[model samples]
Target: MIGVIATMTVQDGNGPQFEAVAAELIEKVRAQEDGNLLYQLTRSKADANVYKFMELYRDADALRAHGTSDYFRESFGKLGALLAGEPQIEYLDGV
Candidate 1:
């Protein structure tokens, strides 16, 4: 299994829009990606504008498929304008 963690900070006044878009993207990814084991969006308790995405995939191919999907591309395009800066992403391997 593969795990991915992505962190993003929303631009001022963009939290609601970001959350709405992310929710829809999450739903699409969960429903359409056969190798997606888990997909979750979470907000920081200390800062409402800080968000984290937790994802689990069956393997590297699954991860690649998720990144290349049309739905993901579309959603990311929208999400780009709402972000404060570049997102931070980390990849992990299951033990």
Candidate 2:
């Protein structure tokens, strides 16, 4: 299994827009991606503008499929303007 924690910082007052895009993508991922064990978005308690994507994939191929999916790409494109900067990603191996 593969775990990923993707940290994203949104521009001031852009949280709603970012969340909307993420929400749509999350729905699609949940409904369409067979190899995705989990795909959830979480907001930081300390900062509303900070969010993280917690993802669990069945394997490397599954992760790659998610990364290359059309829905993922389109959603990310929508988020570009709302982001403060590049997203930070952390990959982990399941114990």
lDDT of 1 by residue, 1-95 (tens): 99999999999999999999999999999899999999999999999989999999999999999999999999999998899999999999977
User: Among all windows of ten consecutive residues in candidate 1, which has the lowest summed lDDT?
Assistant: 86-95
List of clashing residue pairs for candidate 2: none
lDDT tens digits, residue span 25-83, model 2 = 99999999999999999999999999999999999999999999999999988987788
**CA lDDT for candidate 1:** 0.94
Once all C-alphas are superposed, what RMSD does model 1 give against the true structure? 0.7
Predicted structure with the largest lDDT when compared to the true one: 1
TM-score of 2: 0.96
The residue pairs that clash in candidate 1, if any, are none
Query: How many pairs collide in each candidate, listed in order?
Result: 0, 0
